[model samples]
Target: MAANSPEGATPRESRSWTLRLRRAIDQHLPMGHLLPDRQPYYVGSWVYVFGVITIAALAWVIVSGVVLSFMGPQWWHDSRLGRFVNSLHFWSVQLFFIFMVLHLWGQYFMAGWRHGRAATWMIGVVIFAVSILTAFTGYLTQQNFDAQFIAINAKDAMNSAGIGAFFNVLNFGQMYGLHVMLLPIGITFLVVAHIVMVRARGVVKPIDAEGARS
Candidate 1:
């Protein structure tokens, strides 16, 4: 018998890198919890579906945006296939924002920040703000009269906030870079972080209507 073991005892398994990673996953996101076969009956409300629907819309937006990017702005404006993809991207944005707003309202009215979930709620708020900025940059990349009008008007607001010189809303190159790269990266980070936090904390429970009326 080894000095580290007592008589008739089984040897303990060493914590290898793969074992450590698996342990971390179990601790943070156990399989049953991450992919549950069932949920609390309170989760049956239609309101709960809005968040997932928003995510679906966001996915389609990204897919269509990718296609449009590969085709270029000129192709999107002039070609039939490009216009269809552009329309898909545009409609996806509208759906994403609409459902996102609904989700926000639902959470707000439910007092979703309660019970140590403030961090989750705060992350959701930040995601909303970042999404708005991402959409604004998308508008600036339109390369049309609408884009021009938005840029010229938005530049004044940016200047008043003391960032227009650098941000340069009227500069298509800068806006395009932000729309396709910087802002998307930021939004992606926020969304991933928010989802992880949500999974960790679980969904907020419904509050009492009687308590509210009182």
Candidate 2:
């Protein structure tokens, strides 16, 4: 401990996990940065809004999906209330994908990978890919003819590729578990990670700054 340190304070090298975590939080996400009322002027572009819209849609999707899971597929197809909720979840998915694609394209052309932000860019890409798989699993859990047909058709290909045993889409229970339990958790994790990384690095500079950096 330094001479000026408090009596019980641990040295930096051997700090407790709790202290380390608090330090990391302060270092990476100071209060103003974490919930800023202002951002760089370049972020004013219309394209920047799509990323937040995509996240909003995802939040709605998850809320509606949780309700749908409790009610189950039969209720969704038969009950008016359930159908309304199902529509919310479905449309939210569509909006999520639409905004996500637009955001991805906008970010890519802006060279979002610049300024030591490669991991942030890669994580965004992974989130997009994983979100598609999550949506596919959602479709498979719908318990409709479309789901049955898709599962049956895809299972053959999955097996030929030697992965069907592990990811047996034909099994309604497996697909349901994945959609309701596993994949949602994964998407939630990736979303959290992407948001944290964004806050840690700050947004990428505008494309014009790219050439100037060179």
Candidate 3:
């Protein structure tokens, strides 16, 4: 037995990378903080619920978008059931933006970035920007005259900005790939990170009544 090894422990077990990774996770994000039974009293406010509502709306958007993708463009543009699902996807995206804006404004007013939460706030801002691009790509993928008009205008704008080479707005395959795959994955990852940071740091406290008046 090696002197550094624990009693009856194998050398590989004592030097396992998985054990080190687990320790790092536990140190940074303990289960207790990750899933607390109770939150701050201020969390009971109606404003706090907007973030959760935004997340729920995003869930619907992803689900409907997946269904639309599997059904393909012809069915979604022609068939009644496919149109219904496409409508669901469209409306859910609207709701997502609506609630996300509400949540963003609510957080801004509350100074949500205070107390080491600046990273969390910044992550949310990135999510918002990425979502805008995702929505724009979705518009470009519509396969209609409207899509063509938007794409032409967007191409002009991109060319003006010197990014048309990389981001060709007229390419339906590129837009569809981004709208359906890359952007969603980025948004989901950012949202998960935002939530984890929020859970780890706990909710921001309500502003003092006196401070508001001042």
Candidate 4:
């Protein structure tokens, strides 16, 4: 049987699709690059920490938001524990934005789009934009007077943009659905893509260093 079969060929090697996929992944995102133990010397700078901090804040946001989702709005407003969790979610979001902005500006100043990493920069921008929309929908789903005021104003803005027919800010169900589901998923996916691209291309070299080298 061994002689009849191709010599030195394992069962896994016989699967062409799997082999092709493995080869493609290795070529594009090798394990060493994806999860490196070491990085460029410049990566030791404090600015590089901002991106990790932003991701940490986002983790807290997601955890607290999950709890709030399960308990609902009324519980969050009335119950002590729910209120605490709500505060956690709110503060986490604040921190997430703060660190994300810091990271974004840090990268911008460093010309993060350099070294063929434009896609990484663009994905980060998209994540920021999507996060703003997610936060807006979250505010509209608050089910309070403040929410009402925001919805009313936002309705006018959407109407002015000629998208009110499709995206009614006054609709609680729609806003809540987007806040808890769609927008979060979009942001998460974009963030993952951004990280992957960063790993694939490696961090951009310092502008001064590149200039000196050139």
Candidate 5:
């Protein structure tokens, strides 16, 4: 049959990720508005620096978390090296959230969401909330009695609110996967997307004329 017609054309193959991404941009970015030649007028010294620092803190959290996770919960609690590494991971998490909050607050103080950017800001806020919830879940995933005790206590709070009937924080399998994989993936993607939007739009100007100029 003509050499099987070159494997039946292989269904013409789907578009690549880059091509698909470009197509999506073309669809949504309004053409020329996708990029601007002129620099953003409001970028005063270190106006955009917090975004970079926040991202780096997030990176540290993920890298250290991955290494610590491999040490296993038993190793983490039992061995000195594992404990130190685990502690580093924990503190990095704290720093990640701290930096993220500061970064968002800085943007807010500058009124950075004024120019058709509210949707992006909302996404960033949601990511922040999710990250906090994920951190709580991380504490619940420790497998130690402390995790169980905290889970039970929180379950009481959640039960009073009527949600614990659905979610069992004591479920280590679910909590671990959600904390390590799901939340990290969601947070990282949202952070990266938020950053891309910020870069494309530039930091917002200050309200006062002199501040904007500076």
Candidate 6:
């Protein structure tokens, strides 16, 4: 007859969990959350690995970026090892974007954005936007003919968009540090945060009560 009771046994069972936690703490006993016995959480979707592959690609980008950073900007253009690392970094970026785009698309179709998972999806979209901006800035900092051309072409659009006032695209020095350091750090943190949220909430199952299997 409790006001909070919808189904008596179900509410009582839920409340019992809280009391057990309290007792465990009072008695200094180890307590853990009961994980669902759902098998739907890790359905054999290859798309599941797409997001992970993107993370792995980002890791490669970071490693190559670090090597290139120690060599400095000019060294990449002048030295064989530096140039090879730069190419590796460039390819890693391409791979990261490819995998992430696919992951996002797959999530959308799978309706992985359902439940309380909307926040996770929104945060991920923002991270994707940031990564794109980082990539553009990265391409601008190469200081090669391609970089010069892009800087010239992209300069006006940025100025028109008001971003040019805050950032000087022509400044390879600043862009270099931002690409290899600041933005990479930001992207890495975002990915880690996203993964934490995913693991904490667990994967959502589709409609038709299939989540019970999950």
lDDT, candidate 5, residue 100? 81
lDDT of 4 by residue, 1-214 (tens): 0113333447777466666556656666799999999987667789899999999999999999888888886788888898899889889999999999999999999999987788788889999999999989989987889999999988988999898999999999998988998999998998888898888778888775654434
* Error in Å for residue 42 of model 4: 2.0
Candidate scoring better on lDDT of 1 and 2: 2
Which digits, one per residue and each the tens of the lDDT, describe model 1 over residues 1-214?
A: 0122222322343335455555556666687767667776778888888888999999999899888877776889888888889999999999999999999998888798876688888989999998999999999989899999999999999999999979999888888888887887887788887777677657766775232332
The segments of candidate 1 whose C-alpha lies over 4 angstroms from its true place after superposition are 1-22, 208-214
- What's the CA error at residue 80 for candidate 1, in Å? 1.3
Which 10 residues in a row give candidate 3 its minimum summed lDDT?
Answer: 1-10
> For candidate 5, lDDT tens digit of each residue in 74-149?
7888888888888888888888877788878887887777766786788788988988888898999887788989
- Computed on alpha carbons, the lDDT of every model, listed in order, comes to 0.81, 0.84, 0.87, 0.86, 0.73, 0.78
Error of 3 at 192 (Å): 0.8
Candidate 6: misplaced stretches above 4 Å?
A: 1-42, 210-214
**What TM-score, over all chains together, does every model reach?**
0.85, 0.89, 0.87, 0.88, 0.76, 0.79
Ranking by lDDT: 3, 4, 2, 1, 6, 5
* Pairs of colliding residues, candidate 3: none
- Between prediction 5 and prediction 6, which has the larger TM-score? 6
User: Candidate 1's error at 83, in angstroms?
Assistant: 1.0
Better of 3 and 6 by TM-score: 3
Give model 5's TM-score versus the native structure: 0.76
Candidate 4, residue 46: the lDDT equals: 93
- Cα distance off (Å), candidate 2, residue 146: 0.5
Candidate 1 C-alpha RMSD relative to the actual structure? 7.3
After superposition, candidate 4 runs with Cα above 4 Å error: 1-17, 208-214
Alpha-carbon lDDT of model 1: 0.81
Q: Who is ahead in TM-score, 1 or 5?
A: 1
